[model samples]
Target: MDIEKYIRNIADFPKQGIQFKDITPLLANKDASAQCLENLLQLVGGQKIDKVVGIESRGFFFGTLLAQKLNAGFIPIRKPGKLPYTTLKESYQLEYGMDALEIHEDAIKKGDRVLLHDDVLATGGTASAACSLIEKLGGEIVQCNFLIELKGLNGIQKLKKHIVNSLLQY
Candidate 1:
């Protein structure tokens, strides 16, 4: 599948001077979404992922699917106060602004292998912060994967220490 075609570009979404890569089109198409999920699985290439962590909103879409496909625990890295239980917070910067993500203190067991998923890697702040929370809880990150990565933003620079995979780059 030409997954890139499913990505719709929106000008000045949420704010000006930012081009948003919308995945709603892809999500609406069962075939493309499945193909993208298969591609994500292929990126793992048989790594044993004990847990799959998805970022707050958009990540939840494919994150749940990935967890089901892998038979791994699905964890949500949500915005502050979103999680009901005791949580650890990590603050970070975004391309447009600043935000924080929270993860349950017990989300991952010590030494658990984690796969982090997000819809897009724009500034790396969200992913980097989420990674900190995971490690603070003693979870070893296996990989950080995304549905789309904005290459010009160089989000990978902040995630240089870990394996980062993406199905589509813009």
Candidate 2:
């Protein structure tokens, strides 16, 4: 699908020396978007995921579709105070600054196998923090999935203790 071409690169976006990988172009292409979703679903297929935990914002887009494909419940890990129920929160560092994420307290039951999904994995801080929250709530992290991964960032290294997969790498 030449997904790379569809990913727009914004130099020094949100900060200096940071090239942001934008997926808006890919989303505009119907065929590429469908293929990307299918590929993501297949990559994590047969993992026995009970819930798909999608991080805030972009993760929600792919996470919901992946959850539907796997026939598993979609769990959203949103920003703090965004959820309407009792929740658990985790604060972490990003390329810009410190940020927080939240997940419903009753989202995953004990022993539930969960797959965390996001559009891109930059530094592994958000994903790792989400994994910690999921475990604290009794959910087992089966895998973590992403559409694009920036190589040499060592984001995957931080998450090396778990199964992590990405459809594209840059």
Candidate 3:
């Protein structure tokens, strides 16, 4: 399936000099969404996943879908106090300052095989922070999955320790 064709590119969106690759167009089409999900699942390569840790909002979309398809528990890693529980947080450095993400302390058990997910891999700060939160809870990261990866940004450098895969790269 040509999933890239379904992606909507918006120039200078959400800020200046940023080209956003929107997935809503792909999400809107049933077959395209299903195909993309299948492609993402293929990235797992049949490995057993105990939990799927999805980042914030966009990650929640296919994150839950991947969990359901894998028959694993879905764990949401949110920003700040979005989760109503005893949470563990990990902060990361941004271009100007710092940002953080939180996960429920009990979200993952020791030795659990986890698949961390996000909609896009930008500067790698967000994903790296999410990885820290997973590690703090003792979950072994099986793979870091993303729908789109912007290679020009060099996000993969920060995630050098893990297996990274994406359906589409820009």
Candidate 4:
């Protein structure tokens, strides 16, 4: 669907030298959003997914839809204190400093197969931390999916143990 065309690039966004791949344009276009979701689903190849673990805010967009399509529960992995429940946290190194992500302690059951989704795979810290949270809760990661991946950042290196797929890479 040439989804990249729908992604608007903002230079030096949120910080200097950072080029943000904005998805707002894509979300605004119904057909592009649908096609992107469909492509993300294809990455699963009809695998049995019990839960869709979405990383914080952006992931929730397509993550919820993917969960619906897969008939799986949507689990949100958010910043510290965002979840109103007993939670499990995992900390990771970011460019600036260390950060943590939290998920409800009971979100996943033992042996549950999970599909992790995020908007972008930058340095892999965020997604990797989310994976740790899922594993700690006894969930098996089925696949780590993304809408966009910055290949130059080498985020995939941290996620080498699992199947990683992305709709677009820059």
Candidate 5:
């Protein structure tokens, strides 16, 4: 399924000179979404994933599905103060400034294998911060997965230490 056709490009979304790849079209179509999930699972292969760490709102969409399909726990990495329990935080630099992400302190156990998921890989700041939080909780990052990747941004650079996979690249 040419997933790219299901993705809509919006100009200057959330900022100027930025083209946002919107996945709503893909998400709305059952066939496309299923194909994407299947592809993601293929990328994961048969590796053991103890937990699937999803970054923020968009990540939740496919992250939870991946967790269910893998029979792994679903952990949410959100903005500061978004989590109710004791949380750990990690901050990273964005193109314009900085932002922080937090996860529950007990979200992962020592030696747990984790798969990180997100909607897009732009600057790598958010995903990198999530990785830090997971490592701080003693969760070993198994792989970083994304629905779309802007290769021009070189977001994968910050995630060089771990395996990174994505369904689409632009």
Candidate 6:
């Protein structure tokens, strides 16, 4: 549906030389938002997703909705200490700095099939870290899905072992 048109491009955002893709426009439009969700749902039509693990913040929106659409449980991977229960954490390096992410220790049960959902795929650090956390909790990553993918960043290259689907690429 060419969802890119619905995303506003803000130049030099958050810092100089950075172009931010904002989804606020899409969020405000009912048809566009519904179409985006429909497209994402179609991508995993038959996969048995036992749960949908969303990366923190932005991912929460799409993850929770997708989980409901798929009738799967929603699991969230958050910043350290953000989760109220015992957690499993993974730290990784990024171009700017190093950060960590955590998932509840018991978020995933043994042999659970998970479909990880996030708003964007950039550099793949966060997604990769989340994938590790899911595996640590004994979940099989059935697939990873996103609304947008920054292709220039080559984020998918870092996530080599699982299937990845993105509705729009930039």
- For 46-76, candidate 3 gives per-residue lDDT tens digits of 9999999999888999999999999999999
Model 1 C-alpha lDDT per residue in residues 1-170, reported as the tens digit of each score: 89899999999997999999999999999999999999999988899999999998999999999999999999999999888999999999999899999999999999999999999999899999999999999999999999999999999999999999998887
Q: Which portions of model 4 show Cα errors greater than 4 Å?
A: none
Task: Give the TM-scores of the predictions, in the order they appear.
Answer: 0.98, 0.96, 0.96, 0.97, 0.97, 0.95
Residue pairs clashing in model 2 are none
Model 6 alpha-carbon drift over 4 Å, by segment: none
lDDT of 3 at 138: 96
lDDT of 3 at 127: 96
lDDT of 5 by residue, 38-121 (tens): 999999999999999999899999999999999999999999988999998898997657889999999999999999999999
For lDDT, candidate 3 versus 5, the one ahead is 5
Q: If candidate 5 were superposed on the true structure by all CA atoms, what would the RMSD be?
A: 0.8
Candidate 5 Cα outliers beyond 4 Å, as residue runs: none
How does model 6 score by TM-score?
0.95
Candidate 1's clash total is: 0
Model 1 off-target regions past 4 Å? none
Query: For residues 91-163, could you state the per-residue lDDT of candidate 2 as single tens digits?
Result: 9888678999899999999999999999989888899889989999999899999998888677997788889
User: Distance (Å) between predicted and true CA of 143, model 4?
Assistant: 0.3
Q: What overall lDDT goes with each candidate model?
A: 0.94, 0.89, 0.92, 0.94, 0.94, 0.89
Name every residue pair that clashes in candidate 1: none
